[model samples]
Target: MTILLVEDDEVDVMNVKRAFKKNNISNPLVVASNGIEALEVLRSVSPDRPRPKIVLLDLNMPRMGGIEFLKEIRQDPELSSLSVFVMTTSNEDSDKIEAFNLNVAGYILKPLSMDRFISAVSTLNSYWTLCEFPG
Candidate 1:
């Protein structure tokens, strides 16, 4: 299954790509710079390009943020069931609480170190491999 990564920072996007490569994650990784673009991509799913099995989202962005994206999706019946994991720099309790309230699958804090970041991605890779997702 494909994985969607919604992040505005180019550096963070590169980091995720690097981590996926290091972890030997073969899933096709699609990217969107912001929540608005992400929703556009998700809604444009076709037989050739299926919807992402999960979304790895960043909280802060220019046009639309992760929290807003979560709220929007949760309110739409067609998108509400999409599995989303918050992978962001925000470590505040409020952010975590709000994310959980919106029914996010998991909330992950971005690691400062490259090694730790790769380790976290490796763990996520393993988790997705073990879990069965709906089509």
Candidate 2:
């Protein structure tokens, strides 16, 4: 399964990559620094290449933010069914509620420790590997 990670922090991106490596999740990982770039990538998915099965997004970004990205996805008929999960450091209740309202697949707080991050990635990997995709 291809995973698209949308985050602005380089450190966080490296850490997540490491965690994925540690967990033996070998799917081709694509990354977008912010929401705008993510939109471009999503727009480029075609029948020849399957759309990303999951998107790991961060709420805070330079250009368009995660919420804005979600709104765009919801508004686009071609991409409305795409699954996205907000994995961010923001712990505010409002953020969580808004993400849920936007129909996010899951909201996960970024784990601080490497071990925990690895575990989290492992669980996510298992989920994607086992979950059935809709036709």
Candidate 3:
């Protein structure tokens, strides 16, 4: 399954890629730098392009943020069922509440250390491997 990672930081993007590689996660990963770009990618109807099975979203971004993106998708009939997980730096209660209210599958705080981040990714890899998603 393809995972869409929406993040603006180049370093963070590289870290996810590195962690996936290190963990031997062979699933295809698609990237979008911000919420708008992510929407464009998700909304595409290209026959050959695979839809992302999940989204790893960052709350703070240019143009549009994660919360707004969640709202947009939830309101759209075709996209409402898509699974999303918040992988962000924010630890605020408001952010957490809002994310849950928007129906995200999970909320994860980005670890500052590389090892912890990789471990988190590995856990997600294992979890997804055991689950079945709608096509």
Q: TM-score for all predictions?
A: 0.96, 0.93, 0.96
Clashing pairs in 2: none
Candidate scoring better on lDDT of 2 and 3: 3
Model 1 lDDT per residue over 89-134, tens place:
8999999999999999899888669999899889888888999887
- Candidate 3: give the clashing pairs: none
Write model 2 residue lDDT over 46-97, tens digit each, in one string. Answer: 7876677689999999999999999898899887887788999999999999
lDDT of each: 0.92, 0.88, 0.92
Give the local distance difference test score of model 1: 0.92
State the lDDT of candidate 3 residue by residue for 1-135, as single tens digits.
889999999999999999999999999899999999999999995778877878999999999999999999999998898889899999999999999999998999986599988998898898888989887
User: Model 1, residue 39: what's the lDDT?
Assistant: 96
Ranking by TM-score: 1, 3, 2
Candidate ranking under lDDT, highest first, comes to 1, 3, 2
lDDT of 2: 0.88
List candidate 2 stretches off by more than 4 Å.
47-49
